[model samples]
Target: MSKRTIDYYTKIGILTPERSESNYRFYGEDSIETLHLVSQCKEQNMPLAEIKEKISLYYTSSVEKEKLLKYAQVLSKRMEHLEAELKEIKPLLDALNEEEQKSIINRMSPQSMALAQSLIILFN
Candidate 1:
């Protein structure tokens, strides 16, 4: 709803709202949906070039349903891998008392924390 939101989408080439006679930008359903998809992909930390390629593939494919199904399959596999890692880690996490958890946090690097967050999100 804000100019910054529109500007971000425009910068990504995900949305191109048309200007009205009064120079107000008007976003249609397609643009809004594209923006939503772009935001979701970004939240997952998917690379922009990969996102662009996927978007183009979605639009240009004659067998869109098949392509979408394939993409879903890939995502499913990723989710499965994440789930397995979480399963392996959950017991260890649960076994740690509060003090241990604090100690682990104190010793963990930022990169390790980020990786853990990414793994959790992927599974989630």
Candidate 2:
């Protein structure tokens, strides 16, 4: 928990802390948990390299799950926004003649067309 210990851990790649523009390092919840893990590992006389490997394994799964959850949240928000836009535009689209709708669809980029189709399929 001491600054020197943190410095050593950072130097050895065991603990990574965010640094400010002025170079002050900041530790958060993750760092606190890592420090506790390191202390426990050291108590059992684990080598630094081994402890680092263990922490890397821990972070790999944890970070992947965090990234996936964040992605799902962003995707959910995007889907909600898309639904709202579609609702607002539905009346206008319906008023268009078949040829006009075809013209609009033709003007869309292939990727956009594909995404629209995908969204339609998803909603149905």
Candidate 3:
């Protein structure tokens, strides 16, 4: 990793560096692993504040891997839930009888129709 990235993490208190007699910042093996983790979290687009908390937890206990895994699983479940809900909407729309569908279309004003179309585009 670049020196700038390491410096940033240190500045933000996510990683602490040891100081030599000359006052040069130095990192141990654990700090190296922490930097690797910070990189991984950034790749997944986690917020810096949240990454700091995760790393803090990693340092505090023996269940570091489990904590990270739980975060990943929660995110995975949310995506799955949203996908299922979106999929269900399609079948519900399809199941509406022709008359029901036409009635909804007929009742919708031009502005409402446009809004509905926009909403569909946004979600899809």
TM-score of each: 0.46, 0.47, 0.52
Q: Name the better of 1 and 3 by TM-score.
A: 3
lDDT of each: 0.75, 0.81, 0.80
What is candidate 3's lDDT per residue for 1-124, written digit by digit as tens? Answer: 8889888889999989999999998999989899899888887677898788778777885667777787778677745665666567777878999998888789978876775665566668
Number of the predicted model whose TM-score against the real structure is largest? 3
- Which of 1 and 3 is ahead in lDDT? 3
lDDT digits (tens) for residues 22-70 of candidate 2: 9998989999999999998787566787688767767885566655566
Clashes of each: 0, 0, 0
Q: Give the TM-score of candidate 3.
A: 0.52
In terms of lDDT, which candidate is strongest? 2
lDDT of 1 by residue, 38-77 (tens): 7777877777765665676656747577767877776777
Global fold similarity of model 2 (TM-score): 0.47
- Sliding window of 10 residues with minimal summed lDDT for model 3: 78-87
Cα displacement (angstroms), candidate 2, residue 33, comes to 0.5
Candidate 3 overall lDDT versus native: 0.80
lDDT score for residue 118 of model 3: 59
